[model samples]
Target: MPRHQLRLDASSPTIIVPITARDVTELDQSAAASAAAPAGAAAEWRVDLFTPFTDGGGGDPAQAVAALERLAGLLPNTPILATFRTTAEGGSAEIAADSYAALIDALAASGLAAAVDVEYRHPQADRAIAAAHRHGVPVVASNHDFDATPPTEEIVARLEAMETAGADVAKIAVMPRSAADVVTLLDATERRYRQARIPLITMSMGALGAVTRIGGGAFGSAATFATVGAASAPGQLPADGVRAALDLLHRGR
Candidate 1:
């Protein structure tokens, strides 16, 4: 398929498949999963989620870069997101801000990543956003809440902040404490999709929020995250489940 702008609508719900595999065997497993993904889903290769990074507290930055490059080569044409999510954001590793920026720069420079995920709250995020654009790579300005879901107004404000920070796609992942919280996220997503010029990706994490990932496209969420084996976040459905749900939603529409 040609490189198409990922459309976030009933017809096509953007899917971001995770790359959490460790060695070449696991990487191949991820690739196989990607190849077998439903027709409309996109791939998100998360290098930091692999066992190597977690087991060794993350290896040399150069090694990580090399690994990303190799994985990119394996999964050609799929949109790969270089995400080194920090400890503060529920990610495993504790990479320094400067080093993280350098890694993003190197990935962009190498043309290995289609986009990079930068936290909206990070101090150096603006610089990273600028650099990614400079190298012709898109940036997904992201925020995550492991504790609890903020109100709908707060979610809107957070997305607005990401937009102001120069993000191509504004992403928010919140931990929903109840069904009502998921509704709040959906409401915010609908409002932002209608008002904001850029694409919006919103998900409420944990068991209470799993349905949002399945039904989010109907509420105007741009993408949903899924893993090949283990979930990167709580309440993440498997790729097949996501595909089936999206298909059912589209059919119903």
Candidate 2:
């Protein structure tokens, strides 16, 4: 059978669990465990197989490829996302744009992941996105603002840029210091939901803005990143907690 093509929709929230287990067997078990759980609030439970954002890349490309090959065999039907976030963008690792693009291209061709994430403003985002497209893998054009939320209009423009660059998903993560700032993030996501060309995955990081992580799905965001054992981003709730929250909200509670 052909591989399962990943698709996230606006019907309910797609809760993504970032897998951080260093042990390969542990990672496969996490994926299997989530898949075995009964579906309720979350539209889907997808896996984001990636390193925590602080090391840039602790290992070489060959090691990464080896890991991907393992994941493919372990979770053949599950949707996996391959992401390499840079330290400059609130992640811990950094790689040259050319090499990053090359790595993404290779991963897409490997068929281990259904989608690859590219920092939207990276110098070689276009190259990486194009390469993913050529391999029939979707690209999530992502941007991060760890310090503060940009103006709502500016956020809209950023999403538009991602759409123009051929992203299948336009994602933005921002930090909010106050209730007002979280409101701003939601407003931007709502506006883009109507106008943007593709689905959105936006969130406000940190405790002050944590509500936005769960609430964004109600407003317009299509996906939320949740943690299993470790969190890849701030304000990430555990996957089970996220599903529960989505259930409550979806019921108008």
Candidate 3:
């Protein structure tokens, strides 16, 4: 397989386009469309959106691996960040904590994805982080607050917690209720960025927070999500537009 790692320290933030296909056929189509993303952009496989995983509780680990292989074949040049978000975190699927950790362990060991996202608050989060590290795969430990943005101190604490858990990257996304909320999220991001040992990904979701998706790098966000065909989250802009904005905002920095 081709080797491509997602980097957050680039002059411009890494533009990650979500691939939200539900099946192999749809995955093929989505993978093709993702090629239209900016030249250096990466693809995030929203594995929870895949029907096989959503059919019952959690899908077969073998099936998930097979699907990942197919995606890797389809987009050899694009780095893939595998994310099997659960319903509790505004995702489509629901899985037991043990099952969730096992899936992450399997995915990390498979070496198909450039990085794997593990929810920070999951009961077995530490287990998943350790397993992923044993395989030399970076883990993007993440937390999402779809309700509202937390206080700046709380946001920074969560990021620090992820780092302490041995994650290679720390990510958090929060829904902003007002313009001030967006600023709060940004301030937290910059604060964590200044002290963080690993890369950080932070965003304030929704229309009021859309600016973060385009120019969050200025405030220390290492990466931002964008849409290729279907959006996996609120306020995700078109990948091409996000890429251009990131370049413009971070130019000459």
Candidate 4:
């Protein structure tokens, strides 16, 4: 498998494209087009093997891994981040904690993906991190609050928790009820970014929070999620749109 470690820093924030695959062939075509594009973006395939957010219905662990392997064959040069978001976390499917850990372990071992996005609430979060490290793949500890944005301190606390668990990157997504909420989320991201050793993928969701999606890097966010074909979250701009926004924002900085 190819190596896929994200290069994020204080100066340069990257764009991430989320791919919600309906089928292997669809994923391959979308990924192939993205691979041929000039945009500097990473691909995140949502492997909802048992999740409710899957395009058609639930799938087994083997199906998820098989799909990933197929995609790897098509995009040898593209870095893929495997994610299995659960229903409770605004995803469509659910897998027991043990099963989740086992699936992540398998993905890490396969080397089909550069990183695995394991939920922060995963029962064996620490174990998952260790397993990914053993396989030389990164763990992205992620949390999402679709209802409201938490205080900056609470957000930082969560990011720190991921770092302590040995995650290479931390991701937090929150919903903003107002413009002020967006500021709170960004402030929290910037604060955590300054203190944490790991890179942060933080964003406030929805139209109210769209500005942060474009200019989040200015406040210490390491990457922004955009859509290549289908969007996984609210207010996610197209990859080119995101790239253009980032370029426009940075030129002024």
Candidate 5:
């Protein structure tokens, strides 16, 4: 098994700017924002929500792939995570599982994406992981709870399952109803990170849990998502905002 640690030295507390725009111009803007940010690591092009990939917008699979290729060429060497989150998994679009799997395969084949996000609950999760590994790409096995945060034990179990299923990194995003819920997520993250072999990325959503996005690294979160403009998840600070928060946290500001 390949052991993957958080690339803290490369980009400690990296920022992932969401790209919700459809136009090529907007894509350029998103890429530029990512380039301008202080994040040491690569940026993610959320192709699912971006303009050319969304439903009824002529953002079919071919167009999405073309956009990715274009972005990959433009952002040379800056790792790009290709994510086409499905509606079943808190994403705004609805693409069939088989089609989604094929799209991921295409991205992997192109050698354009450094990483890919695959839902832990997806029926094709294993196949996706295998394909990513075969193509020398890393896989993020992710789970999101938009309604409520699960209990600490359940959270640990879910993360463990992702790890066992062959994910290079396991991510969990939950909607917290209270401050105590944040504690539950933190505790789960810390415990899982210490006990598990794979890297862990966990966060609690909403204003009540906003601090988690800032201080989550201390508890073993490998990465957190931020946006250039619109937040993909609640409580996400903008890319620059996260960078500033991390700087202040590290400096004790």
Candidate 6:
């Protein structure tokens, strides 16, 4: 299948709508919704939430590949970011490091996904990243903190680390306990954005940090995840709403 990966734009971040489903039926519905998203939008298949991969990551590789093929067909025009988020990083699935690396390798080789999300902290993360690149699939090396936001320098270091690890794009999401934490996340984003070679995706999740979803582009984030139906993460405004806000903020640029 021809890949139509969404190109990230720092001055005007692209909107990514996440699709989470537990079964094929729900997958169909969610995919349809994501497919119907406005132009310039992309879809993130939250594979961890899917039933096949929920059983301790013991899901069959062939079945997973087949499902992704079906999903690709459904969203033919939309770029798909295949992600199997692990429980250690605020995800629902729990799989061994080797299995995780193998799964990512398979997805990267399938030619069905425009990109794949690799957990930067996973034990086999380096192996997974190398495999994905070997297959010519761009890797979005990501880290998520659900408890609290790390210091600005720590966040910046993580993003830089992802770049050093050969990721095509670097992403980080953090939970904020106060308004200042949100600033810290964005501050780190800007500091990194000013010097980084690859695109960046950073956001402070939750109600207190919702502004990042709308205005992160100004801080140099390349994309922001939104929602068409069920959100994969917190503080995710609806796709249309986020798009409008982004346009308004970057208008006349």
| lDDT against the true structure, each candidate | 0.78, 0.74, 0.89, 0.80, 0.77, 0.90
Model 3 pairs in collision? none
lDDT order of candidates, top first: 6, 3, 4, 1, 5, 2
- In terms of lDDT, the poorest run of 10 residues in model 2 is 40-49
Q: What's the distance in Å from true for residue 151, model 1?
A: 1.0
* C-alpha TM-scores of all predictions: 0.90, 0.87, 0.97, 0.91, 0.90, 0.97
Instruction: Between candidates 2 and 4, name the one with more favorable TM-score.
Output: 4
- Residue 80, candidate 5: alpha-carbon lDDT: 76
Q: Write the per-residue lDDT of candidate 5 for residues 1-253, one digit (tens) a residue.
A: 1122225321256666666656688777777766675646556677777665564543466777788877866667577778878888787776666777777777776777777888889988888888878877788889999999999999999999999999888889999988899999999998887888877889999998888888898888878888766677888887777788788776752
Q: For residues 187-224, write the lDDT of model 1, one tens digit per residue.
A: 99888777787888889998899888888887778789
**Per-residue lDDT for 1-253 in model 2, tens only?**
1155556765577777665555567667765665653353121212223452234454456656677677666666567777777766776466676877887887788767768888888999999988898888888899999999999999999999999989999999999978899999999989999997689999999998888777887778888887765677788887778778888888743
Q: Write the per-residue lDDT of candidate 6 for residues 87-200, one digit (tens) a residue.
A: 899888777778888889888889889899999989999999998888889999999999999999999999999999989999999999999999999999999999899999
Q: What TM-score does candidate 2 reach? A: 0.87
Pairs of residues at least 3 apart in sequence or in different chains that clash in candidate 5: 21-51, 22-51, 52-59
List ranges where model 4 is wrong by over 4 Å: 36-38, 49-59
Superior candidate under lDDT, 1 versus 6 = 6
- Runs in model 2 lying further than 4 Å from the true structure: 22-59, 251-253
- The residue pairs in collision within model 1 are none
* Per-residue lDDT value at 132 in model 4: 74
Between candidates 2 and 6, the one scoring higher on TM-score is 6
- Candidate 3 accuracy as lDDT: 0.89
Estimate candidate 1's alpha-carbon lDDT, on a 0 to 1 scale: 0.78
User: Candidate 2, 246: how far from true, in Å?
Assistant: 1.3
Per-residue lDDT for 98 in model 2? 82
Worst window of 10 by summed lDDT in candidate 5: 1-10
Those runs of model 1 whose alpha carbons end farther than 4 Å from true positions after fitting are 1-11, 50-59
| Reference-based lDDT, residue 52, model 4 | 31
The residue ranges of model 5 lying beyond 4 angstroms of the native Cα positions read: 1-11, 51-53, 56-60, 251-253
- Deviating ranges (above 4 Å) for candidate 3: none
Better of 1 and 3 by lDDT: 3
